[model samples]
Target: MTTSADPREAARTRLSAHREAVLALSHSLHAEPELAFEEHKSAKKIADLMEGAGFAVARGVCDLPTAFTATHGSGDLVIGITAEYDALPGIGHACGHNVNGAAAVAAALALAPVADDLGITVKLLGTPAEEYGGGKVYMLERGAFDDVTAAMMVHAAPVDGLGFTSHAISSWQVAYTGVTAHAAAMPHKGVNAADAMMIAQVAIGAYRQQMIPGGIVHGVVTCGGEAPNVIPGRVTADYDCRAETAEDLAALKARIRACFEAGALATGAELELADVGRDYADLRQDAEFGEAYRRSAEALGRSFDLVPSGMRGGSTDMGNISHVMPTIHPSIGYDCGETIMHNPEFTAYGTTPGADKAVLDGGLAMAWTAIELATAEATRTRLLTAHAERGGRAAGAAAAR
Candidate 1:
C-alpha cells in the first residue's frame, strides 16, 4: 500500500528524526564560541554533519576559510539557505548564531531526503563573519548565489514575526596622521591627530541634524593619543552610516567624507579613508516569498506582528541579497522580552528552551516555504515574475543614478 503525500506530515516526521542532532549542534556551538572570520571549528562541525547526510560538500568556498556550501538533489528549483556562526567580540554567541547555524543545518537535512521527490534542489551555505564582516556580500561577489532562484534565513528576535526593515549601510575606517611632540613643551610644533579626529566627530554630530529622518551615523575611535602627555602621531576611527536606500546611503557617505576632510584641513593632518567592510544595500522584500513564509509559519501556529510603518530598523548584509534576488529574513521569537540582541542577558537566553523552540519552528517554516515556492506552479510564476520585474527596475534605477 502506498501512502498519500502530505508535505506537512513528512516535514514533521523528518524534523523529529533529526531533533537530537540539531540540538546537539546548537549546544556545541554555544559552548565553544568563535569570533568573526575565525569559525573554523564550528564550520567543520556543520560540514561534517552535512557530509554525513549525503550532501555534496564544498569547503572553503568564496576564498573564505569558514565558508562552505552543501548541495543535495539536482532539480529545476534551486533554493539557498544560509547559516551564520560567528560571535561578537568579548561576548561569545551573544547573537545566538549557534542557533542559526544549527537551525539552518536542520532545515536542510529535513528537506534533503525529499528534495528530489519535491522537485527541488536544496543548498545550505555556511557564511562566516556576519557579526562584523559582510560575509554574504563577499560570497555574492564570488558567485555563490549566481544560480540560486531564492534564498531564505531566520533570525532570533525578542518577538515573533517577520523582522523589521533594515537600513542600507556602509562601513568605513578613517585615519589621521600628524607629528608627535610633547604636549606641554612643544604643543605648537606637533599637529594632534587625535584633535583632528575629535573635530571630525564633532562635524559628524553637527551634521546629524540635517540628515533624513531614517538616517543613522555612529562611530568609535579605535586609536587615540598613546598618552595624555604626548601629542598623538596617528589616530584612527571606524564608522558606520545608514540610510533607507542605497542611493541615500551613498549620498550620506559623501557628506560624511567631507566632514573628515574638513577635520584634516583644519588641523593640517593627512586623512586616509578606507572601506572596512561590505556595503549593505537596503532590503527589498519579495512579496511572493514573504507571503509564502507567512503562510507556512501560520500553518505551524506562528503569528506575525507586522512592524509598524516607520518603526522597523537595523542594518544587515542580507539586504544586499534581497536587492538582487527573492529573499526573506523573518524573525523567530524567543520571548526574552525587553532584552534586546547583543546584550549579555540576551545571550543567556539564546540557548534556553524557548530559543530551541524558535530553532525548530523557524527551520521548519523556512523549509516549508521553499517547498511551496518550488512545487506550487502558481507560487513559482509569482516568484519568477517578481524577480524579473525587480531586477529590471533595479537596473533602470541604477542607470538613472
Candidate 2:
C-alpha cells in the first residue's frame, strides 16, 4: 500500500542526513573488536545509537546478554534487519563485521521515520557471536523471529554478490582416550591415542575420492601427545564438515562419524566426537527479495557479480533464517587488494573510504528494498501470504507439540 507520498525517497534523505554518524559507528566497531558472546561494548554501542534514533531498544533478548532487539512501529508486517558485531579470534574485524553492523544500523535509522507510513515495523536485531557461536540460531529457537515478516542483511565481502549460496557447516570437538605405557619398552602393552587420531585422519583422506561432490572436511589435531618417548593416553582435535545443504551436511557428518569410529575400533581407544556449536544451514536467498535488493543497489551505482570467484560462500547463521522465511543476504563489496576475508590484511580496509561508501550504499539500498516490499502490490502480497502461511504452520506445529 503506497502512502500519499512514497517513503523510499524520505528514507534515502534520512540516510544521507545521518551519513556521518553511521560511518562513525562503523569505525568505532572496527577500533574495538569483541569476540563472540563477549560483545558487550559493541552491542551497547548499537543499542544506544538505536535508542537515540527513537527505537524502543530491548537489551539481552532471548537470555543472551549481547543479543537485543531495537524496533519501531506496531504494524503486523515486520521487517527484520540483523546486525552482527563479533570479530574473529585474532584478526579483528577481518571479516568486516564492523561494516555489516553499521550498514544494518543505517538501514534501521533510515526506515524508522517512515515505518508508520509503510505500515511495517523496522526491527534491528543485535546478533552476536557470528564468528564462533550461532547467535541467530539461538534467537530463532527462543522466538526472536516469531513475528518477522521477512529478514534482510548484507554481508561484507570483497565483491558484490547476489543469490549466492553459503555452505551448511558443523563443528566438532573430538577426543580419544587410551592406556599409557612406556613407548620404547612396552609399546605393544600401550593403547596409543595418537595412533587412533592418525587412523581417523587416514580414513578421512582415503574417503575423499568417494566423498560427496560438495562435501568438505577439515580439522586440526590440538593435542597429539605429551612426549614422544611416552605412549599418548589422550588426544584431542577440532574438526569441521561442510556441505551444500542441511540434508547433505547430515549425510556427510554421518560418513565422517564412521571414519572417526574406525579409529576407535582399530586402536581400542575410546572416542568422543562432541558438537562445539549449532549446525549452520546452507543459505537459500529468496529470489524475489534478492531481485528487489538488486534493483535498489543498482540505483546506487553498485554492480552485481563483479568478481569472478567461483568458490561457494562460507557458513553463516543467517542461512537458518532463510530456510524458514523470505530472506535476503547479499554481499556488499569493498575494494581490498589481494587480501582475502578472515586475514589480518582485510581488517585494515574495513574503515577505509571504499568501505565507508559500502556502508552508506548498502544501508540505503536495504531501506529502498524494504519500501519496495511494502508498497509494491504484487511483492507485498507475496510476502504477506508467506507471513500468514508461516503463522499457520507455527500454529499447527504448536498443536502437535
Candidate 3:
C-alpha cells in the first residue's frame, strides 16, 4: 500500500477516466444478449477489452468455453472481481448483468494502473452462465479460484442493498414416460404422462403447506402434450428448489422427490429426475468486507435504508464462492420506475443513464474497497492467512488422494 492521502480517491479518478469505455461495454452487452454456457460473443467482447487494457488474458478457462480470466500485476494479495454477462432466455439483460459485467471491467481497469504500487494482483474473472449453469460453482470445483484471496461483485436491482443473503438452490429436469393411445378409441388402454405431471404439480402445491420455512419450489412444464386427441406419451418439466442452507435444501429436495414419486406410483408413469446444475450454497457474507463496501458506497452518496422485512432475495452462484473465501455481493440501484427484475420493463432501464451511473459507482466502490483491504494490515494479514490455509488444505487433499 502506498502512503497516500486516499487510495479511494485515486481509484475514483481512474474509474472516471475509463467511464466511457465501461459504459460502452455495458451497452454493447445489452444490445446483444446470450444465454448461459453459450455466451461466446459476450465473452469475446469482454476478453478483448481486458486484453486491450494490457492484462494477461486466458480464454476458455476451466474447460468452459465462455469462461476467461485476465490478470494484471504480480502480488501476494490477489483480489478477484467476477464479471457475469450471460442473459436470461428471453428477458435479455433484465437482471442487469450488462451493468454487472461492465462494473467489474471498470474496477479492473481502474486498479490496473495502481495494482503494482498497492502490492495487489487484480483478477477479472469472466464467469458465464450464472443464470442457469452455475459457472462459478463449476469454476470453483475446477480450481479457477485456487489462488484468489478474496472475491466480490455488484448486482443491479431496483434499489441499493447490502448485507442481504440469498437461498441455497438445486434445479432439476424432470420427465415422465408412459404409453400413448387414441383418446376416443382406447383411452383406457394407455397411461397418461401429462396426467402424471398434473398430479405431481398438485402434490407439490399441497406439500407447500407442510414445507419448511424459507423453502421454495417452482417449475415449468416445458412439454406437456402434443395433441388433445392422443394420450401423451411423455411429459417434461424444469424445477428449482431453494432453502436457507445446503442441509435444508437437501431435505427440501427429498420431500419434493417424494411427491414426484407418488405421482408416478399413482399414474403408472416412469419418472426420472436429472439434476440440471450444481447445488448453490447459501451466501456467507464476510463482516469486514461488507462493512468496507458499505463505507465505500456511502462515500459515493448511496444510502442504506433498511430492507423491508420479508423481502426475500433470489439465489445466486456467487453464494458458493462466498463460502470458500471472503466475498461481498452488493446491489447497486438504478431507476426503473416500479419495474422488478426479469421483466421486459426492467430490461429497458438496464442501459439508461441511471444504470450507467450504477456501473461507474459500483466499479469505483468495489475498487476502493479493494484499496482499503490491501492497505489495512489486519485485514490483509487475515486474507493472506486464509489463502495459505486454503492452499494447504488443497495440497493435503491431493496428496491423500
**Residue-wise C-alpha lDDT for candidate 1, range 231-302, written one tens digit per residue:** 999999989999999999989999999999999999999999998668888877776688888898888888
| Runs of candidate 3 exceeding 4 Å displacement | 4-6, 306-311
TM per candidate comes to 0.93, 0.96, 0.97
Lowest summed lDDT over 10 consecutive residues: which window, candidate 2?
304-313
Put down candidate 3 lDDT per residue, 1-401, tens digits, no spaces.
Answer: 56545666777787888788899999999999999999999999999999988999999999999999999999899999999999998889999999999999999988887788889999999999899979999999998999999999999998888888889999999999998999999999889999999999999999999999999999999999899999999999999999999899999999999989988999899999999779899987788998999898999899869564224589999999998999999889989998899998899999999999999999998998998899999999999999999899889999999
RMSD of 3: 1.5
Candidate 2 collision pairs: none
Note the residue pairs that clash in candidate 1: none
Q: lDDT for model 3, on a 0 to 1 scale?
A: 0.92
Sorting all predicted structures by TM-score, with the top scorer first, yields 3, 2, 1
Number of the predicted model whose lDDT against the real structure is largest: 2
Candidate closer to the true structure by TM-score (higher is better), 2 or 3? 3
Runs in model 1 lying further than 4 Å from the true structure = 1-4, 309-311, 384-401
Higher-lDDT candidate of 1 and 3: 3
Q: Which is the leading candidate under TM-score?
A: 3
Alpha-carbon local distance difference test for all models? 0.84, 0.93, 0.92
